[model samples]
Target chain A: MATSTALSTTEAQRRRARRLTGEVLASWLFLLPAGLLLLAFVFYPLFYLLYVSLLHWNLIGRARFVGLANYSSLLQSVYFWQAVWNTVWMTAGTLVITLPLAFFTAQFVHLELNRRLSGLYRSAAFAPYVFPLVASGVVWNLMLQKQGIANWALSLLHLAGPHWLSQGVWPLVSIILVTTWQFFGYYTVIFLSGLQGVPPTLYEAAAIDGASAWTRLTRITLPMISPTLFFATVILVLQGFQTFTQAYVMTSGGPNGATTTLVYYLYQEAFQFFNIGRAGAVSVMLLILLVAITLVQFWLSRRWVNYDQL
Target chain B: MVNSIEPLRHVLSVPPHFLPLHPEVGPYAGAWNSAPFGLFYLNTLFMASAIVLGQLVTSTLAAYALTWLRIPGRQAVFFLILIGLMVPEQLTVVPVFLEMRTLGWINSYQGLIVPFLGSAFGIFLLRQSFLQIPLPLIEAAKVDGASRLQILTRVILPNSKSALITLAILNFIWHYNDFFWPLIITNTNHYRTLAVGLSMFFQSGSGLTPWNQLMAADVFIAVPLFLLFFLGQRYLVQGVMTSGIK
Candidate 1:
């Protein structure tokens, strides 16, 4: 009886081992396509980008190895510094206008407006976000012209409108305005969803405790939605660094390169001047900057972003 | 209600001469005559559809493996996908372009479509949805001697319809509106997507590019996406909310 039991136990162990191997094989079979594509397209290119950053090539001759030359030259270039400054300004400008307006609009939609009307408002606001950036840039380009509707509206207000897409500061501002218009609705919807997640009983309790509406909002609503707010900020910053199509379409990074954001500079370097090495360097720098910003945001979120209730 | 009706009343009171049919002449005609927008539309449609289909297949299968399959190093694979999320396309664009050039894929459909087939976002979203499926159901299927493929197709997929639709719609819109990749990959009119085609058209002209025709072209490029967003607002919004929170 003991020998028979020993044989059965060994057989069971073997079956279990085979089943485990089968599971691993099946899992790999499922993951193979995605894994291969991601590695080939995404991961492999990342390492290749780093390598290309160290080489001097223009898609023509031999890619001669140059250590730190691309990086040093990029750092020294006035145009690169200008691009960085423009990108920071554009990002800061958009975030300032977009976040506040979106929050207030979301609040109004969630709290003040009737339900049916709020749907209309949300759709109307989000309509602009659906338009392709190229299309939005074209429409806004026309509107921001010297004699366009924007100036016409300013004229009605008895104020002179600047040359929006023509001059230095105005071009950056025009890009910011178009960006804010394009994305305001998206952030508002995000905020709206965040707002809906806040428990109503908290407000009721605050009211019963004789808390003012302002105090209640500061104490309750803001804390509850901080996570979403943080997420939006991270998204905004990442996207801000990638501001290309608008500048590319509307300003063409022109008027003395006032609106030449980082990605635009990268594009110009690689495609326009065929400075492939410098472009790779710029890409690596941008990646570092983005990753650093994201890491910083993640670190900071612990202090400000409320996850207690969630 | 009164405020809304006031505008309608004012419009009704305007003279017949105020509102004219065919007010803008030759804008659409001029835009159509200038570019082969029909070709652009076909190219955009084909590319977007191909990407959506590929993403659906890859993401669903990968998500299934990550969620349900018993495998070693599952966390490591998930982490790899998360890495893909952090590395934006801009960071990889230069090398990707060079790689495409090396493969002679520049100005081709494969250049546009293949890189985007494996979407980390889609995998992440579907995995989250897949994780919500009760374990008992899967166990029951296993006990009934059902194969993993059958369980995934007949059980898991049938239950993940909303998530699958959401993924498809979002992917379609993203690829349809994508300008940067198509712009870099395709230089010729024959291969250009609508967004890239429109930009090229706008840039090709010198001064005094016709404003009305440009606007008409912009409308033509934007309308389909606008319609999709309106129709699928729920799924889009839900997708955003899901991603934002978790």
Candidate 2:
């Protein structure tokens, strides 16, 4: 009887081992398509960008192996520095307008307003987000036509309308203003979510301690939602670097290159100049710039982004 | 992972390229001024309708399949869609444009509409929402020999209204703000949408842009969506709270 039992147990163990192997095979089969697509599209393009950067690749000529010449030339170019400056200034300009305005509007809208009115306010604020870039650009163009409603409105108010799309200063403003109209609601939505995470207990305690709305906001609400802010800022920085469509569609790199952001410059080099090698080199720089900016933001976020437990 | 593109307010603050000759008279002075307003409203309405309609059909079917269909390679398909979440739209420009050109659909609504049929983020969001539906209810329907299609339409969808709406709003904002795809595909003014139209206006170089006119036009595009959001604020808040955090 003991010998028979031992033989049965060994047979059961063998069956279990075979089942485990079958499960492993099934899991991998299920995962294969995702892995293959990632390798082909995501990793291939990334590596190809590097390979193209090393060659004197243009549309018309053979791609001769030029080693790191493209990178070196990009580093020395004045346009590279100008793009960097534009990216930083645009990011700062956007943050200044968007962050505070979103926060204030979110604070007010999330307060004890009537339900119907609150809905109107939220939808109205979020309206710019719905029109495609093409539509927004067209609408703004028509409105900003020399004797457009905007100037007419200003004319009524006895103030001269600035040529916002023409000169350097207002072109930058044009890009910034359009961008803010699109994003403020998104940030507001994100901020509202972060605010909900903050318990009412904290607000009640602050109120009991005679804290003003401004004080409670600065001391309590801001700290709690720091993580969300950090995430938003990271996205904003990445976006600021990739600011192409507006420059492409609205300004076309400028009223004298005032809005020629790095990505747009990359697009022109590759498509217009047929300088594929230079474009690859520019993409490489952009990748590096973005990674560096993200790292810095992550490091600074530790100081202010308050993940609490993290 | 669905995200919105930035709008162009900065351009709106600029003046018109060439001011129209002012009729030194009454309300007709302002009536013509509102042409930009009419243009803004028209563009916004068109974009919003297309986006909401596209998202409703695509997300519903994709979500249903991922949730209920007991097909071979189902998990594989879901994961494949999920991989699209991280790929920036810019990367797809060359291939999509090539595809559109081949189809002879360039500068048409079909070119704009067809490619977006597969929305990975929408599928994922709706799938998550479907996952929240209690299993026992579905099982009870199955026991009654209900068709899989009937179960999805009757049981799963009704329970997931809030999630569906949230995904719709998200898709609305995203497709509305899209510029690169529309710009590359469409060539003429007749096909030009708002973002593309604005770009042409800015680059036309006929003259300086009038800031107030731009701002007024900017107001027109922005106001409608803002009003809708206010109406849906609670649901929007609830949508974000559940979708991302949970």
Candidate 3:
């Protein structure tokens, strides 16, 4: 009995050691390709961008070390500040317009509409979301043209339509409006799913207790969908910072840079003018801005987003 | 004729659908003046097909290896893929362009197809789906003396159809809509995709980009994607619901 027990114990130790080795080996094999790709493409490029940011490098010329000059120049450049302001304004405009439209649409679909109509409305709202960013830009630019359908409709109503493409603020407004139209459906769908997750019993109880629709929304629905709201906002903000396609297609940061966003500026510097070093600096700045915003989001999420409420 | 076709009549006479429709084809309701519509449609179909096929094959292989095989350093590999998710494709634009140029693949299908084949997001999403496949099924396969490839093909893949479809649809839509990579890589009109071709047409300084023509082009590019999504929307939503927060 003692010999058998000792033999079994030894076997158990061997099995444990073999399993550990297997796990370690398995993990390495699974991870190799993904790790190598990220390391080459992500980490390498990021550090290279940082390194280039400190230099006075154009595409053709040798990169010369110019520490802090690019950073200082960028900080001082009024164009940089204007682009930053434009990006912030555009992001804010999209959020303000999209959030309310999505909220009410979610409510309409979830609370009021029948399944069939809800499906129709849901698809209608979401139709714009699937359009390629460039395609949406093209379509909206057409719709917003000086003598386009929008103006034609306005003329029929005897109201003067603004020159959407050529004008200063109107182009910005047009871009924001188009972006919202394309994106609002995604958020609405997200919000509807959030609403579905909210237990119907709570809403029923609220209704019985003399809570108005507004009261129920503020007290319950809003809190319940806060997590979804958080996710949508992060995505929106990230896209906003990375706004390039629309600007590239529609305005090209036109009408004297009225809509020149930071990413557009980066594109101009990097690709158009071939100012590689400066572009790298700008990319680094953009990354920093994104990181800062993400930190703020994390902080706010902790305070308001209710993950455990469900 | 549309009125005689009841289902067609309701769709054609609607507010959104009140736009234009070309006979025997999809919506081309707007003016067809600026450029021929044929170019954009063919280009978009070609690009979307290439991207979807490449992404599906590459990502599935990567996911399969990661999930089923007792491969070495699996966790580390998975983490690397996750990191790829965060690296903006913008960063690699220059190098990729250079690589394409060196390979003489610039302005060709090869340029568009090769670099975008391995998507970290696709790998990650499919791996999540693969992980949920029960271990008992694989054990049962083992009892029958099934090889690894047989288990993957016969058992795991057959059960993971929803996940596969979801990935395909997402990939198709994303590739169909992507502009930047296409714009950077392809220069000539012959080589352009829908997004790139449309932008080039608009920006060609060709008589102020005739509004009706542009919107018509937009309709052309968007309608097929919209149809696909509308058809598969339930599955798309289900996929999102199933996939955990990244």
The CA lDDT at B1 in model 1 is 11
Candidate number achieving the greatest TM-score relative to the actual structure: 1
Which of the two, 2 or 3, has more TM-score?
A: 3
Candidate 2 lDDT score at position B77 = 68
Scored against the true structure, residue B152 in model 1 reaches a CA lDDT of 97
Candidate 1: tens digits of C-alpha lDDT, residues B1-246: 111112222312212223433354457777878999999999999999999999999999999999999869899989989888878888899999999999999999999999999888889999999999999999999999999999999899999999999988888987898888998999888889999988888888887666667777887787889889889988877787788521
lDDT of 3 by residue, A1-310 (tens): 9999999999999998897677556545544554454455456667767777888877576779999788899999998888899899999899888988898889889988989898778777777777788877876775676756677778778898999987859989988988888788877877788888899999889989999988998889888888888887887887787777878888999888888898888878877888766777788888889878978998989988888784
Residue-level error in angstroms, candidate 1, position B64? 0.6
lDDT, residue A160, model 2: 87
Q: TM-score of the second chain in each model?
A: 0.89, 0.78, 0.83
- Give all TM-scores, in the order shown: 0.95, 0.69, 0.85
Screening candidate 1 with a backbone cut-off below 3 angstroms (N, C-alpha, C), the clashing residue pairs are none
Instruction: Give candidate 2 misplaced runs (Cα > 4 Å).
Output: A1-35, A153-158, B1-87, B91-177, B182-246
Total backbone collisions for each predicted model = 0, 57, 15
Give the B-chain TM-score of model 3: 0.83
- Candidate 3 is scored at a TM of 0.85
